[model samples]
Target chain A: MITPITETDLLLFYYQEADEVTTSIIREHLPENTDWQYFLNELATISSESSSLMCSPSNTTLSIILEESRSQLEHTL
Target chain B: MNAPIIADGVLIQRYMQGNQAAFETLLNRHRNRIFTSIYLLVNDRYLAEDIFQETFIKIINNIQAGKYNHEDKFLPWAMRIARNLSIDTIRSRKRMPVVVDSEGRDVFDCLGISVQSREDEQINQDEISALKHWIRELPEEQREVLILRNYAELSFKEIAVLTNTNINTCIGRMHYAILNLRKKMQKNTVRVK
Candidate 1:
């Protein structure tokens, strides 16, 4: 049986931000681990799906505030 | 009349120079991300909206009063205000914090994954589905870490700064989170078998 994948190794793989050497090692050894495929799929879904949720705030509210701020500034000036 | 928005620092400088249009432009650029983060924290739509408005109000009033500093990074500064206000609201209400990562998905604790039989695709899919369910059940801290790290694409450094914790602690939290999740999965698998 292959050695258990370290959390760090898996993390590097899942993030896919790891260096080439580490990634190559993970790629080379991944097939030996039955669970790696499931992990890979989950990572793919998570990286893609979760990213959309992480963007900064909406522009509508900001526009409203901006309009109001502009109006108030105009009136004052 | 459509054009790219200016940088946050440049916008702040213009606003400080009494340029309302510049300020408005900056607000438009950041509102969604700011509001979404606030909403995620409070978990109440109305409260989140209120806090979102209040945060901008603070920024505007501070700017007008010559109290808002442009040198400080705008995004984190705004987020700090929103986060503090949301945390205060949660505390005052004495409500246990509820994290909603998905629109309609079930919560599952993502501790450690189970030892799955790789030869069975059906079994693997079932295990994965079960894992998703468990991730939803994890505690707020663990769930947030998993979501922020795995989903938010935030660097460990960013998460550490945001959470006011060290990287090792964040990693440990993640480790425990996965361990707990894996244990739960193993138990469930055994039971189902």
Candidate 2:
């Protein structure tokens, strides 16, 4: 049986430090029914979808914060 | 009017010179990454917004007061503020019983992730939510490393500096985090099946 990929191996793969052969082996052996697949999928890209998981504060809220924060900064400085 | 593309340092310099547009550009550029990092840490929407505002307020005031450094490295500086504020909020909230279950899609630790388009994402919502649940359940150190690496997109070296720890320690924490998460997810899978 192929050895299960360790945490270190997964991290190496995540960071693109793993050689192609190792990652390919991992991809082949890693079960599709695990959260590992989910995480790898989620983190595989640097897109806004991955970021939405991190909680994207709305643009309206951000705009208000920016405006109010500038006012506070102006008053303080 | 089209805003001239400027370096982060130039943006800061212009903002310091009372150019509101420059400051807006800078804030717009970095808000999502920085705010998302803060939210993942605190796990509260209003609190995250408060800390985000306070962080930018600090940044703007500091620059105006001539106390800001790290020119052109705006995100890290903003991120440091967000991190500090988040830590303070968490520390102060010691005993707040409620934990956010991956966007409150569930009442408790169980969360449902809605599948959405994200640069060719392939994971289903259930798996993604399970991953989120496991992530939030990880120890704070490990979770912080995960958020920095995954959400903030920070390099390990940058994380080490921000967390004020060694690289090996940070890496080790991330390894343990992922391992522990995998272990839990497997258990969850078995329970469901």
**Top candidate when judged by TM-score against the true structure:** 2
Q: Candidate 2: give the clashing pairs.
A: none
Candidate 2, residue B166: the lDDT equals: 92
TM-score of each: 0.58, 0.66
Interface RMSD of each: 6.3, 4.9
lDDT of 1 by residue, B43-88 (tens): 4455667788778878877766767676766776776677678778
Candidate 2: where are CA atoms >4 Å away? A1-13, A16-52, A69-77, B1-5, B95-128, B189-193
Point out the worst 10-residue segment of candidate 2 chain A by lDDT: A42-51
lDDT of each: 0.63, 0.71
Specify the highest-lDDT model's number: 2
